[model samples]
Target: MKDSNQEEQRPKTTFSAPVVLPALLGLGALLAFCALYPEQAGRIFPSVQAWVVRQFDWFYTVAVSIFLVFLLLLAVSRFGQIRLGPEDAVPDFTFLSWTAMLFAAGMGIGLMYFGVAEPLQHFLKPPTALGGTPAAAKEALQVTFFHWGFHAWSVYGTMGLVLAYFGFRYNLPLTMRSGLYPILRGRINGPIGHGVDAFALVGTIAGIATTLGYGALQLAAGLHLLTGWNTSTAAFRLGIIVVVVGLAGVSAVSGLDKGVRRLSELNLSLALLLLGFVVITGPTVFLLQALAENVGGYLSSLVDLSLRTFAYEPPREQGWFAGWTILYWAWWISWSPFVGMFIARISRGRTIREFIIGVLLVPTAFNLLWMTAFGNGAIWMDSHVANGALAQTASNVDALLFRFFEYLPATRAASWLAVVLIAIFFVTSADSGAFVVDAIGSRGHPRSPVWQRLFWAMVLGLTAMVLLLSGGLKALQALTLVAALPVTLILLMLCYGLWRGLLADQAHSTQDLAPATSFWSGQHWRRRLEQIVHDSTREDVFRFMQATVLPAMHQVSDELRRRGVLADVQHDLDEGATVRLTIPDPELRDFIYGVRIAHRHLPVFTVQDASEDGRAQVFEPTTFFEDGRQGYDIQYLRMEEVIADILRQYERYRSLSANLRTHLLSRAPGHSEPMS
Candidate 1:
């Protein structure tokens, strides 16, 4: 019974019914479509893709352009210094590991598949420049960089920023609908929230399915290219899907730390080795020169590329833009939920500016280099060695990378390496995507169940296989674009919602800063001064929390309950002995006033020995609020003083919540509290 009570006191997360139903229904539809109606699916998938691309080309173009602009403005805004968690919080992952995960999660597989293909396509038939000319090669690199650069990461960063801010800072569930908390309020736990998450899940499946489609095909191509084994049949592709999905399941079961993170690190190492091989074995100096020029050309043409629509150009060039640039934007937007939430999960304590800048710039630098290495290498060999072979066959984009590798030394080894890299990238993406979608399905429960992870892994694989067998890769691509359409609108709302939430936080922070008056102004000040001067041990802090803090919290809770407000007291019997008073308001998010004996690095001035100087750490009874903001220590305060502090904090929370309230401002005079 004691263990049961402790378990009840501990924090727990669970799913909502409304979210699960719609998500499963969508999942089932995909499964049934692929398994039951294979032939019809094949024909319908391609037509659907073509129609969306044809009709909504302009919408996708405009939506993506705006996403990039919004990210830049948000980063430069006054809220940049705000940490995603508390004001004093630091980053969880270090810079190097974080950067590696960014590459691994965001663009690893796509870059491998399209690194050579996109650039060569642009070179073969430059939309604006003459084909097979010097200008075309430069334009090819520039265009590839543009598609894969700031806009894509900005879309991802915005989604991540919203989620991380709400989850860590505001105590909302870390999911897509939670980003709309400022707008939806508690309704986010309702049908509307379910709908938002459902869309994200569906989009996640489609986007990853598209990537898997590309991966399986590319893997098959590598196999045939290396050993002359014909792996192009539908049966062969299905086998690859089975193998990738099974591997993803193993990784998913292992969880993030041992599974995804380790794979991501390996992916980076293999990627570096392959990149070095290309840079060393292929056109070494030309690739370097092209990388520098590519950066310059990309900057020069950024705006033109961002906002371009072929109002005056020939229909063919317009078609080209719609086919390529718009498609990439839609693809990125579709993938943002999985990628963004995954990014958010890893980036708990990072500041807003650090996150936006690092997420945008780091992957982009690698993206530019990756494109230049493979893209430039392919172009150089086409012109110098293969005599335009790769450029001519750019139509068959999937196999183009393998063909380009044949021009270099150790063609078989390099081709095999490419296969392994794509396979690992495939597993990383699927495993991560499964984990993310499960979180979405379970209404943002981070540790729902292993079965959910495995279930989604199978769903993701099945979705990709179905698309490949039914509509082929084109079908998967089409579904991605179509699914991303609604999320574009959702993302716009989230931008405004994040801004509103930030304004409230900043206002609360400004108002909540108590005047730095003396906390030791009472008749018992001398006694407390002596206590403060000495090092307080864990037992001492716990005694203070239990005797003084806990009783004070119950007094406030009882008073609020008698005043017709819903109030409760909770005690956590951990090392810190945290105690909290929760006051919930249906019109706004709940307010929690909590305090714990948290550790801090001991003061530098107190250390006598040089070796032991910086190592000592001490505990301080620290106050933490619902908004993830930290407050001053109340360890020395009496019960009356602690109760007073709670009231003051509650008043400040009410004031902040009032400013951000859009609806339900009025209450009936005789109406009681929610509990009352």
Candidate 2:
């Protein structure tokens, strides 16, 4: 971890080479281009945005395709060798901490904005593909879940796993190389590595810049919705920028563990409280029933919905899949690399399988719940009261939550709560984004200098202000996707690397060595042997030697011990005829010598009494143990070293094994160097 205090001691204004000039140049060029070609830019911006989204869609398709291909190759690669490292010593956070941080970091301002707006939009204009009437209550919650569920979460989870495995598991530096390290481990540290890192950095900044831009626009919209002021005014835009920058700066200065985590926890609690209020005061029965039914619908339709392209022929409103669904998916995928890297940083010590399941499943569940409760409420109102309030309010996404509150019994109270909720949501989302961008820009370390974090935060706020001034939310959204393109490509590469790494791990863990029956094989081994040496020993020593070394020697040794040599050894030792003697092949003799040296240097283990029932137990050498393995006082340093060595050896042998070599050679001809 980088030292926060050390960072603070440095001159705050000193900018790193990577950030200063490029940022200025990029910002200047963007402003100039937009100014010089205002009309042309405006006309082409949507098409450009659409093209970017399409490219993301294409990138995702390619990623999924490559992932599938890798899966096929993995199936034929060999069995059971590749596996994630040990899961011992992983962090165990309190449920409250876990839930709060995850909820806050995972969702963001988008949830608050979409919570009411998205569901209501779908209810008023239920996708034509569903063959349902507008405002049909049944389709309302379903559509909401479609947009917020597993598909969106999958993008986040996949990217996070790639970063986590490569960053933590491999001990690689935090950069795009780390993200792509599983695939390009040893291949990194070259021009190729620098190129990968540069690409990642550009994509990350662009994506984060775009997100901040959206956040700023949404913040402006929220302010307008609450204050009834025109945020379109230059003063309001500047004011929004100032407020965002100030908030981010304060949080950045406070440091991540204290400021960011504290804010996230508070935001999460407030969101839950708001949800609770909705559940209590709103149509409770309706919300629960809708949630249950929609959850079922989401599960059953998940596979088809995830893959739906929403290709409606130029007639109806392109269905839910294209207009809202695909757009959200593309947006999530674009944001994945940035968000994923952040998640990976926070998720050190977690298993790849665990991280994936949590990232994909937990967030999806929360999204479903939010959509069901809030979205179903809108659907119920439209159906029962015959009010067009939700439909009317949804014309502007900014006012959706406000309108939802207006229809409630305690309108003023609900409005106030909604305002608070929106503010916290906005702050939490901004903080999360700032944290993620800091991680990316810092090359994966969370302990970024306070000033560095503040810099990014300010840049985000400023960029967002520019976008808002230029057009508004649409412009911000357009820019975000545009920036996300390169990041999307990097993520695709990450996916390939993750698949390869996992398969390689699996292959190494399941290697099998058996005796050869052919004379050719025996001769092949004999040619490499230099000599054999014999030693006489007591029955106990002979038994220990045979039990400890024979099986391993069978895999590497050439010749059997000679009876005459053993007799001569026994005679030299002056042992009785009944005493046993053994002679190791020269290679085996070297192996034994190495083992003895290792044993001699082995650290001493001091056992402390930890028996709960007052019974002392002998050390069990055959069983695996780590520190705290037997009530936290065994001091298993030696054990840990031994296990680590075995794991390293297994990895080495698996890479060199003929089966894996053949498999890799078959898959990619010139790229078959074993992953380090």
Clashes of each: 1, 10
Candidate 1 lDDT for residue 59: 83
Candidate 2 has what TM-score?
Answer: 0.68
Indicate the worst ten consecutive residues by lDDT in candidate 1. Answer: 660-669
Q: What shift in Å separates residue 328 of candidate 1 from its native position after superposition? A: 1.0
Report every candidate's CA lDDT: 0.83, 0.56
Give the clash total for candidate 2. 10
lDDT of 2 by residue, 1-676 (tens): 3676676665544333463455456655665555456556566666787775554554554454443343334335542222233445464444455556666766766787778877777666666535225335567677677666666666666676666676665666555566566555566766666555554444455555555555555556655666787876767756756776687678767765677678877877777777888887789987887778888887788666555555544435443444565566557766665666667656666555555556666777878878877877776775566466567557787666766766677766766776666556556556666666656555555345566777777766666556556653354355556655565666677767776776666665555431112112344344224211222123433343334333333322222233232211111112321211233322111111112101112222333333234433222112111111221111122223333433343343334344654444223334445565
Per-residue lDDT over 4-78 for candidate 1, one digit per residue giving the tens place of the 0 to 100 score: 786566444455667767776876686577566766666786678667777887787788788778777778988
Which runs of model 2 end up more than 4 angstroms from their true locations?
1-24, 52-88, 92-95, 129-136, 190-199, 202-232, 310-320, 445-447, 482-486, 504-676
Tell me the TM-score of each prediction against the true structure.
Answer: 0.74, 0.68
Output the worst ten-in-a-row residue range by lDDT, candidate 2.
Answer: 590-599
